[model samples]
Target: MTRKTILSAVGLVIASFAVLTALNYATAKRLYHSLTLFNESVIVENFSNMSDIFETVEIEKTAPEHKFGQAYQPLPKTYLYKGEKRDTENFLEKTSTTALVVIRNNDIMFENYYRGTTESDRRISWSTAKSFLSAIFGVAVAEGHIASLQDPVTQYVPELKGSGYDGVSIKNVLQMSSGVRFDEDYGRFNSDINRFGRTMALGGSFDDFAASLEKEREQGEYLHYVSIDTHVLGMVLRNATGREIADYFNEKLWSQIGAEDSALYIVDSYNEPMVLGGLNLRTRDYARFGKLFLDNGQWNGKQIIPAKWVTESTTPDAPHLKPGKRDSSDINLGYGYQWWIPENADQEFMAIGIYDQYIYVNQKAGVVIVKNSANINFMDNGFESATETVEVFRSIVATL
Candidate 1:
């Protein structure tokens, strides 16, 4: 009687454990699916509408430039209502923004969220990730993993030999002048950039994806913006250090920069990071990165990146020519390494991303504006408005 009862009780315990496990699994799966649907339908869809609204507005005025750190001290609080309108409403009405951050003199001046974006949300950086990649390159160089910016990318990624990046120096790739015929038109579904995105999304190896491109012209002769250039940079960093880009970034920058929160790099199906545009982080953490650059790569009294490299990488000395030409009359906006230099009086530059992501750094005004958006269709329109908004913000800082 005792043996039979003991066996029966053991069987019942096992059965009960199995039932609990199955219930937990089902609950987790259901929650994940619901969150995914909300992200796509609510977050992404609302962002699309905001982008469309921004495209219709015409930015007619420019703001005056203020001296760096003069207007706000110890960071200005986020303006709840500039007038009768909420700040989020202004972005939805005037710009395609899911998140926006403004910092002056290493302090947060203004931070805002729109379309349900929040401080904890991790927004996509798009090509703004390129500038971040460039910073990693700087750290690699400083750490001696990469010999120099002048080193040819092929030296590390031998597979790129005879490809579009065959003779391209790391510096050329950083400047987006590798002379590869990469179509960056996001509106065209069949464009090369879109093809690359598809390849990334489909679990293709980034190295193989980049090697598939053919060289169209000599490196360093054109100012064409090629996203692959950054990929090549990532490849070089990987090969040179024999480490994953995410691991390298976490050790060399994120952890060292005292990032307030953990960030995730969106991974491909095979777990490879979409190094070109898949970085996601909090807005204030992004501000920390911008402030690192503003401080010449010094964080907590440590030289995180060589100050000289920061100076040269952002300085615009390279010859800017139209694509496929050695000479042109177009007054090209300045570009150095992966950073963009505005064409006006203020010496402000930015790390701009598709769909309105921006790391706008104004050295003269001591302001850094970091924004993230989902405007996959409106490129030129967004840029024009962002430029104007930056000028206006700079002007307001000056008045204060």
Candidate 2:
């Protein structure tokens, strides 16, 4: 063929291929956007009707038991929030939230949704899942799967022997006093915590991800809020029970808790459940957990978790209390066995997640509050402002 003819033919082929590729890309992008919008729309619909569902969930009786667990018998009377009332802010107006459920005396008193969140939306729990893991540990101990709280973590996961977690005790890990140096600053992309998150997101094994840490301090000397510490606990659970975390949770807690719907833990690419912070569930199901704790580990009269264990784990005791600090900024909020003790008179404690997820249970008032949010960048000023909203909800429960 002539040179000019050959060149023209080659250019036409290349142009045609580029056009097809661009069309494919555009089509895929449109589909993704559509799906996301649909999901968001569903969330909004669910949130809009959540108040009715909250009203319908019977608060007078206890939840029925299943294979995994049962719900606690709800108390009869609703408590009132006598504190100062605040504005009722919608979740979407403040931040990205899918659902919020509040229960008072076993009856769902306040339930709401925003940003297309629905009762079925399985939003990420972030660090809040740590407290749930701690609950599983309690069950493991009571069932004899784990011998004792005093047992060294290394006994369960031997690979940690030469690591920073070497000398850390189970109690210390539970209380987040592992003293291992970990940068929890989520704002800095280069921080250790962020690096770890990236590794997990890229499909690294939980064990291998943990083993890459360098020892920074002696175990149990200080309270260091590190997410990896919880993963170590997950390893301990897996080693002790010879099962995956998801299986253990399903068998020991989820099924028994009388969970209304099956809840799934967000798994890594390799199918390893993100034990540190990948839990997701319906808002009602999350409230069920809070109610379970408020009932002192009893579900329909069956002691799924030992009462003593729940009391001891949630109580602000050794390794958790900072003596002589009554709301002092210098004193870290009392932390216990993966639970957060608010600086309140009634010893109100909560399970808090990043970006505003919360499960606030007040045994004194027989109230439980569960909220989920996606507040853009972590540690935004909005997070601090959100606390006021939580307090407002707490007040509303006290009045119920």
- lDDT (10s digit) by residue, model 2, range 302-379: 887788888887776764354225432233456778887765537477888776678888888888888787654336
Q: Could you tell me the lDDT of residue 372 within candidate 1?
A: 73
The predictions' CA RMSDs to the true structure, in order, are 10.1, 8.6
Full-model lDDT, candidate 2: 0.67
Residues 78-146 of candidate 1 have per-residue lDDT tens digits of 233333323434444455567767777855666677766677775666777788888888878877898
For candidate 1, give the lDDT of residue 208.
81
Clashes of 1: 2
**Candidate 2: residue 202 lDDT (0-100):** 39
In angstroms, give how far residue 350 of model 2 lies from its true place.
Answer: 0.7
How far does residue 257 in candidate 2 sit from its true spot (Å)? 1.8
What TM-score does model 2 achieve against the real structure?
0.76
Tell me the spans in candidate 1 whose CA falls farther than 4 Å from its real position.
1-92, 321-332, 380-383
